[model samples]
Target: MAYAPQEVVDVVRMAACLSLNLGTPDAQRVTSMVSAGQEANLRGIPVVLDPVGYGATPFRKHLCSQVLRNVRITVIKGNVGEISQLADAGGQVRGVDSMPGQIIPLAAAAAYARALGAVVAITGATDVVTDGRRAFAVDNGHVYLSQITGTGCTASTAIACFLGAEHLSPTLSPASAPAPCPAPATAAPSDPCSSLSPDPDTGTDPSAEPVPDQIVLQPHAIPPATPDTPSTAGPNPSPLGATCVTAPIPSAAASSKPAGDHEPPPYLTAVVAALAYYGACAEEGAE
Candidate 1:
């Protein structure tokens, strides 16, 4: 469906997370994606980017770079070749598929994550997830997944869902909750000094008015999804089964900064969980 840029922004305002996929990008779609992503960032909604076939063409690379530069991405999920190419670490790609036998170092992935300020997930036989400082390897998928199309996109969607649930849930701590956007400032007609000239005795300048009270734009409360919610619950059982098992890797001591100086974002755990679940699903489907 074609969405105007304003419509895209409206949709993103109510969304808990936004996912931008570069599978079959066009100029209009790219424009909408960037607009929606900026809106998502303003609302503190998580944004997931799937740079599909990023290394295949100059246009794809440029589009991916555009999104990365314009949006503060929460998670970036792609195959090893795509991630490697994006990180400038090095890998071969034949169209959208990663060439077999290429070895992109895990450290490269970590460094890329640090540089981009987003969690990076590289899917392969042994999936790798990292935030530069900490990393994890998830071994839970089937080889058959490689034969399928759109699996990478689906994985990115899953990560967005998990992040949305965590960030938008009512139970989230107030300190960590996404801050509400402030409404556009308008001249307050009721301001006593708004139209008043500077008084001779009491120096009050109408031009130099005090800041008006800003109206916090509280988004409409979205009810938590339940089993009864049709949108959240599919009409039929999903062919891809759901399961998750993750093993955390020890943090690399590469940073000169002291440990615990900065805690990893909560979305890091969400990305790991999503990948583990997605890989397990693939395993079950292949079985």
Candidate 2:
């Protein structure tokens, strides 16, 4: 059955993230994937691409090229061979399996990330995640994970979930964040002789009442509004139905620019975290 582009677009409109898989691609599926990816991009939703078996066939390679050219992918996740193909390092892949002794180096993975302007994840015994600058290695998965089917695809889903949570969730920018409440003023010491007559009958001075050692005025803390919280921070800055895509994949030269001393980007961090979590889950499952 042919896939409907409009239907795919509609689904992506309501989705926090869009994941495109080439495991079973057909002409109609490819069209749908491209349409959905573009729609996701327009809405600023994260897009995760799993180029499964990218180097196994010419058709698959062509499809991968088309998607990369058109869609603004947030993450490109695949096995070492698949990632190597994208990086132009020319690794070997038989069917869907990554051939041994053809691992893509960390530097090559980072270079591919730079060229694509997205986070690249190469899964293996030690998964590598990079955003062209900072690189991270996740060594938490079990060897048995390689024997399971769809594990790589599952990793892509996890990364998409992490990216969606990071990007789609409403956050208070520095400008919109509420300022801290000021400290309350301390009461001045009461004057002893200010009152003309102490207390006509009782000789005790009314103004000289004892003051507590420390007057603590509690400031009511205003918790930041979350997505579920009522009266959110004046509509989310990156609302789900936003009109246009804020960040598209840049050119290789543009993306290759130095990142200075700033920390890794949110999308890169999300990818790394996802891989770590997925690997940990695999280890538990093996046990």
Best by TM-score: 1
lDDT of 2 by residue, 1-287 (tens): 22577599888878888889998887778988889889888998889999999989999999888888889888899988888887877788888878875544444556567667788778887666667665544555678878877889888998888787667445647577444212112223232111111221243422233322221111111221133423322232111111111223344455435444223334765676577567656655677
Task: Give TM-scores for every candidate, taking all chains together and pairing residue i with residue i.
Answer: 0.68, 0.67
Compute the lDDT for candidate 1: 0.64
lDDT tens digits by residue: candidate 1, 250-277 = 3245335333333444476567656656
Error of 2 at 121 (Å): 0.6
**What local lDDT score does residue 131 receive in model 2, on the 0 to 100 scale?**
72
Per-structure clash totals for the candidates: 0, 0
